[model samples]
Target: MTVTRPPDVSVVVAVHDTMPYLTACLRSLVDQTIGAGRFEVIAVDDGSTDGGGAELDRFAAEHPGLFTVVHQPHSGGPAVPSNRGLDLATGRYVFFLGADDLLAPHALERLVDAADHYGSDVVLGKMVGINGRYVRQDVYARTDPDLDLYGSALPYAMSNTKLFRRRLLDRYRLRFPVDMPVGSDQPFTIEACVRAERISVLADAVYYYAVRRHDRGNITYRSSPAQRLDTARRLIEFTAGLLPAGARRDAVLARHFDWELSKLVGKDFARFDPETRSAVCAAVKSLSAAYLTGRILDRLSPAQRYRLALAARGRIDLLIQPALHSGSAPLVLEKERVLVHLPGFDEMEREHFVFNGAFDSRMASGIRVLEAAWSSDRLVLWIRAPVLGDGAAEPAPLGISGVPAEVTTELAVDGSGTTLCARIPMRALLGGRRHDIRLAVTAAGELYEFPLPALGRRLRQRRWHRGRPYRISVIPGRDEQMVVRVSRVPWRRALLWRKQ
Candidate 1:
């Protein structure tokens, strides 16, 4: 028995600088088959200095009964504004839409129909990203969603693509972590999914997720250690606070932790510090206890259970996140050489970016097709001239800056093209937190900055210059000992002398 009334839904589309996309998103949403009486659109302008606030007000004025606008300064993350939505929401269900994305014509209707048919507490849909791009997601449509949270939410993950019963959020006090620059959605969605007694699936792909070549200044783009850990910390605390009163409570809570680690930590480990990293590892290690009483812990195979156990410990047991075959280049397939190229990239002049993993994909074929690790005798990076332009540039050696020692070396490149090479005495990185690696360059009369965090954290963003000099760190192979001190990674000797 689905909730048969013309159920009320609060469609919360949070907006920022993307007024253009926000306009289209709102248009498509209100234009949906579900009319104004069925759902209320709440556009929260999260301190958008770029006219998003005015645009929302204009839209609300035009669509009187269908729209409401909330204006506030940027809360730094999605959770705070989302909580604002919860408080103002007068609907029984909630739908989240990103400012720069849109919903399908029948998205709300299909989700509401599914919810009624199954009397489900939550409805999961799919988000297809990068318009006119060669990729698609039919995640929710293929699943037997009646299977429950662990089963459906496992692969069909993503909060923006789903709709939820308001009580599932209220009962568990589910809210986003405003502290995080990215990944605040994990805990909120996970809590709602697991705690909800029934969930429905609308196999229809109802959302458009636009993936871009370069996303600088995007909220998810400004990832940091404290933000990620804070999200995880809150999610765990949320679980502990809402544990049901019964024998199965421990079991469900344990599985919740397991799922959290499996999803959040793996995506964010290289971006965090050793202390927070250790906490995450411990959280992952203890997740198995959730299975005995969780949504579907008992149903998993022994292999799956062991893998979850390994994941919680923050161990990259290949079973959890497998080893990826590294070394790839676009357009050219040389044994070790790479001709790195991004179409229309050269249009912008002057950049100082080192190859850090982009798009955070575990697969090697992801964006830019480049990943690197340096633990061997020497490290080599080959760069080729796509089309030698007005003034040809060569990348200097990977230099160690921000540390006390003068440990900088030039890399070897064949005279024909630029091949960056670095060789160093092992003394530089002995105690972990002593140094920072920077790829320095001079073009158009200025020195750009790219500072590495300490050893333990991996950097995301394969391409960092948002139209300027770009620098980012390794994303996957994180060294667990060092840390970022005052935005610099200084050696322990320098630290020791300073303390004395």
Candidate 2:
């Protein structure tokens, strides 16, 4: 009798009617630098009517030992197919790959190596959106060999596309929830991250998540508002059930609140009909009443918190007014409350419509950087913001953080509301890494953060100190924000620049 050794990694692909894309996906698997002997491909063909099943069979026949093709009746959701593949995974590590997505040639090799090197039960290699698809980049800002799920931005990046240890899954019986037709990946990924002894994040781009230009039939695209709302509610309940009530739990729940809950009341929400709108508001109220802790609510932005608060209080009409008003609603300051003038809502209950909370009377809707320039090797930003307090205002302080450090400056008044002149020493950004700049102001005991628009010039500068060259550039970032990148100029590049 001959014994076959278990593969080091198993790539579980749940296939639907993804044909041409599936071919590319399988090819990527075949070309993996991890070698076919080290990793096996389990392609679960869930009744792929578009000849995808036949393609999978052909690939299995050609690849033989490297591929395993399983056919099952059409499952309405990917969860069933995913669970089927997980049940048959026989490897030290298991990675879930989307049927329509492509992996880099060295993806599995790097993921497996990182997992082994760090003893990580879950290893997330950086993934990017391809073909106009949007993937959140917050968690991929940098690599952390051992990431803290609750302390970091991992909560927002919970997708089941990464590598998971087989033993850990077996130990906890972790599997996708079959009932969740959409968004089931989040629950499975979140639970695995919670139970894993160590979770790692690699900065290398290893996966390409594509949004087929011709086919937007994926569950996420096909899912209705009601379906999304239900899934969000279930996710909130599930996350709340997993961790105890505390800051850690709040951190995880905050993602759901911001992405899921707040999304329910976003711009397109106003387009929903009366019945659908009512249903969404009711669901929001239920979830908020059940799991929205004060800490979690505080974690939300002022706009998000206000929209959700209106929804929770069954003021759908009031919630819809913001969209109708185009945010041109009048702001009335009564004592310490700055309220957006909306009809049918009591001004006294300022908690529901106010920008922040009680005793808060300001908004950053008008805040912007009037000028950004280098003043003697120091980056200076002149910002105009809303004026709140009187001459005795003290105006609070303004700050921006990126490399574990914050540069703060006092807000000054100059005939135009309030202004801030922040002088950031170039030396503070000397490290050879990208720094994500975030700006926030503390006024009236409430903190309001705003995005700095692209300064348009691609502000680039370089300085030579002690014979070593350093370069710094501030440019537009995702979502109209700005980022600062600093690096040490290589000798070759410096010489090239000198010649230029």
Candidate 3:
């Protein structure tokens, strides 16, 4: 009798018209350093019209006993195909990979090794965004052997891209919510993490999420505001039902409020049609009434809380005031209170709209880093900030350790704003550490710290310092903050580089 052992991992890819990107994704999977015997790829082509099914077949035919290609009619979303693939998985651990995304060469091996070594039922590999996609990264700051799902930043990154033990999943009968057009993976991943005995996170670059420059067929891109709101509401309801109402539940629900709910009231909210806007307001009001706990509200920034409160009260007119104020709303300072001057807010209602804390960076304007570059071994940031009365106050670098703010030049000054040049020596960022850059200034006697927004995707610099080489890059965070990562390069790899 012959015995066949299950593969170490089963990668489930739900595909739909991914075309050129699909080829790269499949190729990355087959070329994994873990070897074909260690992992199997189960691809479900969800009624792709764009030859994606043919591409999958070609790969399967070329690599026998490696790929399992399944074809099914379009089920309107990825949940159907992902569930089917999960049901067919025969490996000890299952990983859900996006058809439009690919993995690092050694991602599977590292994930499997970490999972086995830590005896974890779930493992999350560090994911980087390519082609301008923003993936939340706070959870991947370090390699944690045992991560707390509710106590940590895991809630912010509840995508189904992580590895899960098949046994744990089957034990709980976990599956994606098929009824959701978008964000179905959140519920599936959240439940798996909650049920798993232990969860691990790997800091190594494991997944590359690509955002197609011109592909609107992506489900998230195609989903309407209403559809996304409905999905968010459903997710909130699911989360509320999964856990008892308290700090633990509030910790999880905070993600939905900050992202899904707050996103609905962004600058674009003003552009939504009247009916759609009204519907969004009504839905937000209902959700807030049902769930929005004080703990969750406290977790939100004052700006976010105010915006959601207005939306919940069906104050679409007041909600649109911030967007129409040219991003710098009128500020009133009475003693320690900083109140926002919004139209139609009476004296009684005006107090409710006051900034929760002494600082509200959201209402501050012109704190953007228009350009970042290297000059004379120094990192230069051209910052735009509002000019206070008498043009006295200037934006200063804050929170960065051992680095002093050097405003070399006041580039320009106008009634709208002032552009200042801030320079920091690269040496200040050595020691293989990361630093978050924030620009602080005073407006209307109120101090605000704003995250520096980079104009481009990411910026990088390579240099050899103190007989060791380092790679410095400015990464744009998912929450619009900019991060500076300074990493030491291996000697062997550093030697291979051409001399500058």
lDDT of each: 0.52, 0.79, 0.79
- Model 2, TM vs. native: 0.70
Model 1 Cα lDDT, one tens digit per residue, 1-500: 68645337888877778766678878887788988789988878889987889988988888887888999888876777777877788788888877777788888888777777777887776566663432334444574557454333343354544788887788877777666556677667766766778876655464445543244545654555555545555555555565564544444454444544444444455445567666656655553443334444444433334344444544543322322111232221122222222222243222211123331221112211122344442222222211111222433322334443333322223222223333322333332433444433222333433432233345322221222222223332234322222123335433454466
In candidate 2, which residue pairs clash? none
Tens digit of per-residue lDDT, candidate 2, span 26-93: 88888888888999999899988999999999999999899999999988889999999899999999
Q: How much is the lDDT of residue 33 in candidate 2?
A: 84
Ranking by lDDT: 3, 2, 1
Better of 1 and 3 by TM-score: 3
| Backbone clash pairs in model 3 (N, Cα, C under 3 Å; residues 3+ apart or in different chains), count | 0
Model 3: per-residue lDDT, tens digit, 1-500?
Answer: 99999999999999998988899999889889998898999999999999999999999999999999999999989999999999999999999988988888888888889899999999999888776677888998998999998889999998899899999999999999899879999999888887888999988565545555365566767788889779888889999999889898899999999998888876768878898889889888899999998889878876777778778778888767644335454344444455554444342354345655434445344456778898888888877654322312332223222355576434244433456676888878775488877776554555566677655778899888898889999887757678888998998889888653
Badly placed stretches (over 4 Å) of model 2 are 208-213, 322-325, 331-500
- Give per-residue lDDT, candidate 3, residue 370: 79
Query: What TM-score, over all chains together, does every model reach?
Result: 0.50, 0.70, 0.72
Poorest 10 consecutive residues by lDDT, candidate 3: 388-397
